[model samples]
Target: MTISAEEAARRPLVSDEQIEDRVADLIGRAIKRKWWILFLDENGVQLPMIVPVDGAPLVPDEAATEHSIEGLRVIMDEIGAAEVILVWERPTGSTVTLPDRVWASSMARAARDRGIRVRAQLISHRTGVRWFAPDDYEGHLEAS
Candidate 1:
């Protein structure tokens, strides 16, 4: 079925209310998961301790706005050869996206240059989600 452009435009194109709701959902997951994330920025995965970080801006990442790559692809690269990626709960969570994708993209490029294998993650705050890494998580970043 072909909907008219006018009708399509009328559709909510990511409203603040929607964004807030989405972010809130992520926050709930973060709390429930206990946030043992692999914080993959354009710079690759950061230290685990820094993954759960609530504040401290990440430079309004340019990668966050990227449109070429898919989140699942980025995730697969991080998983490497692992059969099970021993991650925090809700393993299907993939909010690391465009306009928010830049950070991870930059870190990913950085990791590529540095030849560092990484596993990055996102942590949402009142402002927005930030990056973190399981390597920096320390002391069993996960509950299990």
Candidate 2:
């Protein structure tokens, strides 16, 4: 259900300390899950090598095109990765927005093309927490 602005405002505010603890906990969980973290470069055309969850920060590229499946596909191919896990970073307390359905499709296509696997996760930078992918988000949210 869509919540009105007033209703959203009525929710309790989260404190910075809470956010930090949450983020740390989420990262710990991700590590336990054995999921590697990667950061998209400024061009959004490239990605750093995957690292352990505790290795380093996984910052999302702000300069990346909103629709960058093709670029991601190329990276996936070049790396010959067995699996691709997308990490989306959003400001604290903000709702998570899933990637374009096309993005997910493209990831799947890349996996098929390379005989690999693909997955994704959302990270709230503000709360330093990770959230489950949106349950109701359907195919590419953005128009191609």
Which candidate has the top score in lDDT?
Answer: 2
TM-score of 2: 0.40
For each candidate, what is the lDDT? 0.34, 0.40
In angstroms, how far off is 107's CA in candidate 2? Answer: 7.1
Each candidate: RMSD: 15.5, 15.2
Cα lDDT of candidate 2 equals: 0.40
Tens digits of per-residue lDDT, candidate 2, 1-79, equal 3334344334321343432343343343222222234433222221336444322223223233222444555665676
On residues 27-100, what C-alpha lDDT tens digit does candidate 1 reach at each position?
Answer: 43433323323322332222122123233233333343232123333554554421111122232344443323
Give candidate 2 misplaced runs (Cα > 4 Å): 1-67, 97-116, 134-136, 139-144
Q: How good is model 1 by TM-score?
A: 0.28
Model 1, 67: alpha-carbon shift in Å?
25
Off by over 4 Å in 1: 1-28, 31-51, 58-96, 119-144
**Candidate 2 C-alpha RMSD relative to the actual structure:** 15.2
